[model samples]
Target: MTNILHITASIRGDESVSTGLGTALVEKLAAQSDAQVAKRDLDAETLPFVTAERFAANSAAAADRTPEQADLAAIADTLIAELQAAETLVISTPVYNFGPPASLKAWADLVARVGTTFKYTDTGPVGLLEGKKAYITAASGGTPVGSDMDFMSSWLRFFLGFLGIADVEVIAADGIMGADGEAKIKAAHQEVAKIAA
Candidate 1:
């Protein structure tokens, strides 16, 4: 069965428009493909930000790490393993200060390990997670997706590319707090249905 890793980063919980839209799309995909989904709610299950100790642990050999470093390494290993096992990734995020949430960034920091998710080469950094598809559900209050003021989409796209997930699609629910917010959301729902189908 197809394994889908769904990561939600909305601190708003049940009231988050992005979470609602993304979850609906994932449900549709699951029903159509019989995919098994593993969810990681960043708001609910808060992940510790990457620290200097964690960095040191990542730099050392697996067998040579200190006790604290080993603990940090194991957490990173588990997160990386989840990504390695999944065929598709569904990221639900809301734009905060024109960027992604801090929790999502922390997750990225943890999973992005040297010689694990990526590696250095003579040319440049090479990403290891290849042949995986990713879908992003981004919600914003005023800033629109792909606009000059919006850093969320481009940042995410670049980060995902850095990890070798080149086949990425973004389904944005933008301008959600604007005058035509309801219409925008309705249109986004229609688009989500089309994409999910």
Candidate 2:
């Protein structure tokens, strides 16, 4: 069976536009394929920021590591394994302060480890993970598409592509703070439909 990893980074729970779009996309994807979905809710009970000790532990060799270091390494290993095992990944994020949420960035730091998700090669930095498709649903209260203020989507695309996920699709729910917010939302949904189709 195809394994799908669905990650939601919105703290607004049911009121999140990104979450709603992500859910709809997953539902559509499920109906189109025999996929099993696993969810990680970063906003709800988010993982702690990686500590200095944790970082030190993660870089240590297994056979030369202390118990604390070993435990932290194990957590990192599990997260990498989850990402590797998934055939597809869906990330729902709301732009915060002109960027991705802190929790999501933390999650990225934990999983994008060298020798696991990516590696440095003679050519350049190469992503170890391959054959996986990714969908990014980004919601923003400012900085509509085609505007100078837009930053989140391009940054996310670069990050994901840097990790070797070339087949990345994005749905931007922009202009969400003004009086035409409802119309913008409808347009976003229409964009999602186009992508889904």
Could you tell me every candidate's TM-score relative to the true structure? 0.96, 0.91
Q: Model 1: clashing residue pairs?
A: none
**Model 1's lDDT to the true fold?**
0.89
CA shift of 117, model 1, Å: 0.8
Candidate 1 RMSD computed on C-alpha atoms after optimal superposition onto the true structure: 1.1
Predicted candidate 2 versus true structure: per-residue lDDT over 113-184, tens digit per residue: 777678899999998777889998878888664355666667767777878888898887877898888888
Compared to the true structure, candidate 2 yields what TM-score? 0.91
Clashes of each: 0, 0
Could you give candidate 1's per-residue lDDT for residues 9-65 as a string of tens digits? 999998888888889988998898899999889888788887787878866778898
Question: lDDT of each prediction vs. the true structure?
Answer: 0.89, 0.82
Error of 1 at 13 (Å): 0.6
